[model samples]
Target chain A: MTPEQEKEKEEKGEQEEQVLVLDAMKRYRNGEIWDFEDDMAVSDGHGGGENGVLLGLDGGTTSTVCICLPMVPSFSHSQLQSLPILARAVAGCSNHNSVGEIAARETLEQVMADALSKCGSKRSSVRAVCLAVSGVNHPTDQQRILNWLRDIFPSHVKLYVRNDAVAALASGTMGRLHGCVLIAGTGTIAYGFTEDGKEARAAGAGPVLGDWGSGYGIAAQALTAVVKAHDGRGPSTRLTNSILQALGLSSAEELIGWTYADPSWARIAALVPLVVSCAEAGDEVANKILLESVQELASSVKAVVERLGLSGQDGKDAFPLVMVGGVLEANRRWDIGKEVVNCISKYFPRVLPIRPKVEPAVGAAWLAWNFFMKECYS
Target chain B: MTPEQEKEKEEKGEQEEQVLVLDAMKRYRNGEIWDFEDDMAVSDGHGGGENGVLLGLDGGTTSTVCICLPMVPSFSHSQLQSLPILARAVAGCSNHNSVGEIAARETLEQVMADALSKCGSKRSSVRAVCLAVSGVNHPTDQQRILNWLRDIFPSHVKLYVRNDAVAALASGTMGRLHGCVLIAGTGTIAYGFTEDGKEARAAGAGPVLGDWGSGYGIAAQALTAVVKAHDGRGPSTRLTNSILQALGLSSAEELIGWTYADPSWARIAALVPLVVSCAEAGDEVANKILLESVQELASSVKAVVERLGLSGQDGKDAFPLVMVGGVLEANRRWDIGKEVVNCISKYFPRVLPIRPKVEPAVGAAWLAWNFFMKECYS
Candidate 1:
C-alpha cells in the first residue's frame, strides 16, 4: 500500500478505537468494570486484539505491599513514590494488632494516598490492583489482604494478593514465565517456575531455620563470631571491633546486655555486609563465614533446580537463575555475587542473571493490571 | 637342670646382686629412681627402701584438688567420699587472689607446712611431690604451681603441675603417645599427638569459637532457634517448646530475661542435650542444627589434620583420631558419634578410636618424672 493510504487507514482505525477506549476509560473511572469480559465491549484498534494477561504481586520484607498492572503504562516517578498510599489503603482494613504491622500499614496508606492525590484525575482511570506482601504466604492471609484492597477501592476493581516473593521473581525476570528467583533480604528464599507451570522452592524458612546467606544470617553469624572472638575462641575479625563500636558498647558483657535487653535482632542482622566487607579484606574468620553462607545459598538454589527437574538430561539449555534483594543488588559487582554465580552455575548450565529492574511495587502494579485485563476479557 | 639346680643358681645370683639391689630398693622407696630408666631402683625389704611411686590428682573446673601419694591401693566407697587431706591443705589458697605470684608463695608455704605435719619421722626422706592443676598452659604457670610444692617440701623434692586436658588425654589414650583425645565435661576440646611428636587440635577453643560439635554450641543454636521461632521468623522446632519447659519459661520474654539476667549463660547452655534428644526424635529443625554442628566439628578436625600434613600421599601411616569429652561419651554409641566418625574417616584413613585411659595429672607427673630423669642423667 502507498504510504499515504496506509497512514489514512491507520488514522481512521485510531479514531474508531479512541471512541471505544474513551467509553471503557469512562467505565473504569466510574468503577463499573468488574471483570475481564468488560474488554469485549471495547473495539480493538487492530482487527485482532490479544487479551492474554498475567498477574503478579510482591509483598516485600521492607516495602510491605506492591502491585503491578502490565496492561497499563508504567507508573511515573511520582506515581511510583505513591506506593505507601496503596500499601496503607490495603493494610488499613486488615485488623492487624502488632505495632510494627500497624505502623507499616499507616505508612503505606499515607504514601499511596499522597501519590493518588497528586495523580488526581488519572487515579480513577487505572484498572486492577495486584498486591504482593511479606508474611502473606498463607492462603488465608493472602485472601485477607485482597479483601482489604477490594474494601477500599470499587467493588469492580479486580485484585490479587500473593507473597512478595512472586514480585521478586517477576521483577527479576521482567515478568518472564520461567526461571528461578532468589530473594535474600532480611531473610532468604528461592522461588522458580517451569515453562510447564510447575513451581519449586527452597530455603525461605526465615532467619532461624534456613534463610542462609541472607543479611540477617550474616549478621547473626557476625555477632556469634564476635562473641567467640571475645571469649578467645575464634579468629579475630574486624567485625568484633565494628560491631562493638556500632552498638556503642565495651566488653562482651555490655554487648550481651545491649543485644538481649532490647533484642533488636534485625538491626543486628543488618551488619552482615560489614562482616562481608571485612572478609573481603582478608579477615580469615569473616571469609570463612561468608564462604559458608555462599555455599548455603548456592545449595538452596541447587535444590530448587533439582526439585523442579530443570536440569537438561541431553545437554539442553538449563533454566535461568536470577537473584533479587539488597545483597544481590549491592554486591552484583563484587566477589560475593561472582562467587554465588559461580556456585550456582555448577548445578545448571543455562543460568541467566537478571539485575532487578522493577521494584516489587511495580511488579505488583503489573499484576493488578493483568488481573483487571483477565476479568475484562474472560 | 632340675628344680634344685635352678634354685641354687638363682640363690648365687641373688647373693652376688644383694648389695646393688639393696641400694636400688632404698633409692626407689625414697622416690629418687625412675622406673623407665634402663637400670632402675628396686624395692627394699624396709618401707624406707626405694620402690615404684604413683601420684594421682583429680583437678576439676572448680578448686577441688586431690593428691594421692604412693597411689592409694584401692579407692573404697567411703575413702572416695571423704575429702583428701591435700584438698584441706590448699583450701586457704583457693580464693581468686590466691593466684599469680603472691598466691604461689602462700600456697608454697602452706604445702610445706602440710607436708611437714604429715611426714612424722620421714620428713627428710620424701623425694617427690606431684601437683595436678586445671590451667597449666604456660611454663610460668607450671613453675609457679611447682614452686609452691617445693616450698612445702625439702629442696630435693621434685615438683610437677599439668592441666586437666593432659590428664584426660593420657587416660583416654591409655598412656599412648600417638592417639587422639577428646575432653568434654563442662567444656570441650580435642587433641592428638603422633609418635614423631607432631600435634594437631580441634574444637577446644573453649566454649566459644571452635567447640562447634560440643554441647554448648548445640545449646546456643537451639536457643537461637527458640528466639527465632518465638519471633515468628523461624521454623518451629521441638527444641523451642522443650527449651521453654526446661527453663520453666512460659513465654519468650521470660526466657530472654532468665537467659541474660546474670552470669548464668552456662546454665542456658546446659539445655543443649534436650534439643539434641528432641532432634533425635525427628524434630526437623533440631536435627538440621545437630547435623550442621557435626559438619562444623568434622571440618575443624579435617583442617587440623590437613594443617599437620598428616593426610594425603606423604604420610606413611594413617593418623589415629580419638574421641574425648562428655558429649562423645554420651553420644559415642549413638548415631551422632557414628556419623562424625564416618565423616572424619572420609577425609583421613586409618583413624583409630581410643578412649583416654590416664588422667592429665598423671601425664603431668610422667612429664615431671621425665624431666627429673633427664636432669639426673645429664
Candidate 2:
C-alpha cells in the first residue's frame, strides 16, 4: 500500500480508540456521582375553600402550574368559559423523563399545594383534577404520570391526564373543545383533532431532531450565524454582540464555554428573546432567522391541516388554529405571527386564529369540570 | 406591561438564574479534581541509538505520534531531506487541554518509549525534542503543557513546543516552512508564517463559535438535517437511519441522550465519515452538506491568505497553501479536496496546494533541526 493509505489506516485506528477512550471516561476523577435528588420543590398545604371545584395542572419540561375552577353540574360551554378561576400556582421543572421521577413528583406536589392554598381550599374540597403534562407522548409515559398523581391525591378524587398539547388546544378553544393548536415554545409542534374526532400532528420531534420554528431553533440558528460570521464563512450579524451581552459574557470564545457548560436545551432556548430583540433592531441575520422559522411553522400548519383534513369546505366552519407558546405569542411586534397567518392562509383562507382566553392550567380545569358536567347532562 | 411582556420579563429572570446555576456547576461533583499526574508514562530507558538525532512529537486532540530524525553538522536544506527517519511511534490522546493532563502524560510517555524502542534511541543520545500539541492556543495553556513536560523530561534536554497547527504547517513545507496551512479535521483553522517570520491565523475557533468546514461543523449540520427530515420541516433523507446505525443506537430519540451523554467535540466530529459516505452514495442532503463545508473552508483559506498578504503578485513567489487534517487529506474518491482547491483557486489561481511530505512529528523534528541549524549557520 502507498504511504498515504497506510497513514489513513493508522489514523482510522485512533478514531476507533478515541470512541473507546470516551467510554472509559464514564467515571471521572471526581468520586461524586450525583443521584437524582428528590427535594426539587417546596410544598405548603395551608388554605380552605368550598367543595366541588376541579383542579387542572399543566406540568412541563421547565415548570409546573395549576389552576382551580368551580365545577357547576349543569353548565353550558359558554358558562364554563365565564366561570371564575379560584387559584393558580407555579413551580420548578417536573419533566419526569428528563429530570427523574422524584424530582417531578416533588414539583407537582408543590404546585398543587400552592394552587389549592391560593384558592383558600382544602384538598377535600377539590372534586377532580386533570394534569396535562409535556413529555406524555406515549401511553406508557402517560400512565407513569397518572400513577405519580394517584399516589399523591386521595383515591376518591377523580383525575385525568394527557400531553400538554391537549391543554394548549383546550385553552384556546375556551371549552369549544375541538380544533388545532400550534405551539412553538423551546420546541415546536402542531396538533389538533378534526370534527370527525381523528387526531393529527406535525413536527414536535424534540430538540435534537426537530423543534423547527421553536425558541431553541431560533437560538441555534443565531448561534450558527454568529459563529459563521466570526469565522468569515458567512455574513456579519448583530447576533454576536446581542447574544454575548444577553448571556453576560464578554466574547464569542466565552459564549462557547457557556453553551457547552450546561448545554441544556431549555437554557439555550431561553436565548430566543435575544434573537428577537436583534431582529427588532433591524439585524439582517436575525430577520432572516425569524423569517425561516415563520416559514417552517407555517408548513407545519399546512401538513397537519392536510393530514387531519381540517380544511373548511363550502359553507362549513373554518378550521380553528390556536397559537400558543412563547415564540408565537411574542411574534406580534416582530410580525412572525402575521407571516405564519399569511402563509397558512394561502392553504386555508378562512382558517380562524385564536389566542388562549384563559391560562392553560385553567383550561385543564375546565376540561375536568366538563368530564362530570357532560355526565350530569346525559 | 402586557401579560406576554410580563412572561418575557419573568423568563428573563430564569435565564439569569440559568447562567448563575451553570457557574455554580463549574465545580465537578467529583471532589477529586485531577491534577497533572507526572508518572503516567513508564520510562523504560531501554533503547539506544546514534547521538545527535532530534526527536519530534505531534500531540493532537486525538492520538500522539513521534518521529526521530538524524541531524547532520553541515547539512544544507537539500541534504536534510536525505537523512533517514530513525524511528516512529503512535499512542492515544495526549491533548492536556481537552483530555485531562494525566491522560496526556500517559499517552505521551507510551509513544515516546515506543518510538525510542523503534529507533534504539536512549534519552542521553537524543539532541532535542519539539512537541506540537493541539489546544496550546494561549500562553497560559502553553505554560501548562510546558510545566507538565518539564516534570517528564530531564532539565538538561533541549525542548520546544507550540500548537499542533504549527507542526501541520511545517510538515507540508518541510524545513522551508512559510505560508498558510488550511486544516479541516474535527476542528478547522488556517495558520501561516511569512518569509520575514510574521505569523497570522484565521478560523481556528472551536465547535460552537467557528471551526468552519471542520468535521464537527459537518457533523452538526448533518445532525440538524436528520432532525429536520424526521420532523417534516425538510426533505427526507437516509441520514437518520445511517447515523443511528453508525452510532449503534435504536431510535432518533435515543440520539438526544447519546449526544448529550458525554458531548465531547471529537466524538461528534467522528460522525463526519458517515455523512461523507452517505454523500458518496448520492444522498442529496449529504451532498449539500459537503458543498457547504467546502465553501466555508474556502472562505477560511481566503481570509488567511488575504490577512497574510499571501496572494500571488506579478513578480512575487506563488503563495503556498498546505492542506492538512482528516477532512482534506482523506478526500481521494469523494472530491472534497478538489472542491477546496477549486474554490480557493478562484480567489488566487497561483495558490499552491501541497499535501504533507512528512508526518507532523517529522515536521516538528525539522523545526527542532532548523532551530539549531540556523543557530550554527548564524
- The C-alpha RMSD in Å for every predicted model, in order, reads 24.9, 14.9
Question: Which candidate gets the maximum lDDT versus the true structure?
Answer: 2
Off by over 4 Å in 1: A1-61, A65-112, A121-124, A226-232, A236-259, A310-315, A318-320, A331-333, A374-378, B1-80, B83-332, B335-378
Model 2: pairs clashing at backbone N, Cα or C within 3 Å: A30-B30, A48-A120, A48-A121, A49-A120, A49-A121, A209-B227, B48-B120
How do the residues A1-378 of candidate 1 rate in per-residue lDDT, one tens digit apiece?
754575578779999999998986665444443332234333421111122122233434433432322233343423433332232222232223223554544444444433333323122333555666666645777676666566555565466666667767765554444777777776777777787778766666544343558877777777767765654345667888877887787755355445555545467667776876787677888888778878877877776776666666653466667777666666522466567888887666677767666576565665454445445655
Error of 1 at B62 (Å): 21
lDDT of 1 by residue, B40-79 (tens): 2233211222422324343544443333333222333223
Each prediction's TM-score against the native?
0.48, 0.78
- In order of the candidates, what TM-score does chain B achieve? 0.67, 0.77
Q: Distance from true position, residue A178, model 2, in Å? A: 3.6
Model number with the top TM-score: 2
| lDDT by residue (tens digit), candidate 2, A130-229 | 8888877777887887886776667777788778888888888764457788998888888888755688777786654445588888888888787667
